[model samples]
Target: MTREQFIKRIAPIAVQLRAEGSPIFPSVRIAQSILETGGTINPWNNLVGYKVGGGAITPYWQGKSVRKLTWEVYDGTRQDRVPADFRAYDSIEDGYRDQDLLFEKDRYRRVREAENPEEQADMLYMSGYATDPNYAVKLKMLMASYGLGRYDEEAVQLRKEWQERLQQLEQRKQALQARLQTLRQALAMTEIPEWAKEAVERAVQSRLIDTPLNGSYDFYRLLTILKRRGVI
Candidate 1:
């Protein structure tokens, strides 16, 4: 498959993983998967090239296994063809979830906390996640070339918008609190006017203001309170 096709197939999964609070950057994971799977139609649905060790498949792994000829770098220079056992999942989603499981390994724990895609890729290489010395470099190149970093950028944008919204809400809350304090101080006056006292009584009767009946009420608060109580 072409790079675009590969991205279209896996990008949603990458985004989903990120939304689910996966510690790994979505772009880094997508880049690594693209590199491992060769951007082809992965019928086996093994997105991350996960290997099955000599031990029996874990009880939780109900999927089949495929032995494929994989290339591994030996002596830090030479590539050797070796047949390795890889998991065969029923679907691409399963493969992606399995990839998340792989990252949970002790060696990959640090990579999960990496600050960015580059850092995560570097940590993966340093932790011997892959034998290729240029693995991190290749992943970085793919990320830059295909605009894979857009996913990270999108997440950052979402956080920024959320923060702005929260700030607005906090400002509104503060303003309301200040207004309520002013109303309380006014209501504590020794000689409240008859009209003001009547409004305060109405607000108290409607349960809009939890303050005592003798409490003061501002014009805005009085209108809102009456409107909320369906009294106006």
Candidate 2:
């Protein structure tokens, strides 16, 4: 697939991972996937070229794997392309998840804590995620060239919407509290109105009103007429 098509396919997954609180940044995730397969979507769904690494098989992996010739660098020495066992998955999403799970180790702490795509790419290299000396630079180049950071910006917007929703809920709660206070204060000021005062007083004397002051604001009009007509 073309580079843009590959990015389009993985962008949603990357953004969802970020929104779901994965420590990996979305831009870095997309760039890593693009770089791993050289901007082409692989059939095995091995987006990051992640190795089997002896990790216990789980839902994200299910013991599937593939072999590919890959490059490596050791102490500034570039090795020729060598055959390696790369993890495969049922879907690109699973591959992405497994890649994140690999970062759960203490050694990948810096990668997890990286604040941006650039830092994340560098930390991935510093954490020995890849043996390529220019791994970080290559990932950064892909991110910038493809505008992969837009996915991270989209995630930021999602968080902003949630924050705004929470603010609206807090405002509603404060309004409810104010309304309750008004009701409590209303009970104290519920004396009989001037128009109904005399009529209600007589009604109270006749025990027609069990609690004369407890009548609702609208009920006072009806109560006044009933008292005047001797209905009490």
Candidate 3:
């Protein structure tokens, strides 16, 4: 697949991982996956090339695994192609989730605290997440080439927009609740007309006014109640 196609396929998974509060930046994760799998689908579906070793599989992984010839740099000098056991997944999402679990381990504690994608990549390299000496650099290069950082930026902007919308909704809710309170107080006055009293009673009976009302109510909710009771 072309780079665009590969990115398009993983973009949703990256967004999903971000939304689920994965500490790893989606862009970095995508770039790493692209590098590990060579931007192609592998039979193992091991996006991160997660290894199965040190009894990591016995108690937890009941699924299948595949032994593949992988490149490993030893003593910071030599590269060797050796067979290693990599955990296989049923789907891409499951592989991503296992990556998250791996980050939660003590070995990746520093990586989890990395402030940004570059830092996270650096931490992964320092933490021995990969044997490639240039792992971090390669991941960063891939990220830049594919414009993957935009995904992280887009996620941030979307979250900010959602927060602003929620704030506006909350303000409107408070305003509606205050209006309802004022209307209730007005109805409580001794000189309230019988028609107003009847309308208030109807609103209460319709459950528009909660008993001992103390919480905010949405404006549209109040409008719907008023319309339904013919009080609008």
Listed per candidate, the RMSD to the true structure in angstroms reads: 8.1, 4.6, 8.9
Candidate 3 global lDDT: 0.78
lDDT per prediction? Answer: 0.76, 0.85, 0.78
Instruction: Show where candidate 2 strays beyond 4 Å.
Output: 162-232
Candidates in order, TM-scores: namely 0.64, 0.70, 0.68
Clashing pairs in 1: 187-216
Model 2 C-alpha lDDT per residue in residues 63-169, reported as the tens digit of each score: 87888888888778887878899887888889888888888999999999987889999999999989888899999998899888889999888877888999999
User: What is the alpha-carbon lDDT for the whole of candidate 1?
Assistant: 0.76
Which of the numbered candidates is closest to the native, going by highest lDDT?
2
The stretch of ten residues in a row with the least summed lDDT in candidate 1 is 212-221
Worst 10 residues of 3 by lDDT: 211-220
- Candidate 1 vs 2: which has more TM-score: 2
Per-residue alpha-carbon lDDT of model 1 for 9-57, expressed as tens digits?
Answer: 8887777667666776779878988899888757788878777754344
Model 2 worst lDDT run, 10 consecutive residues: 183-192
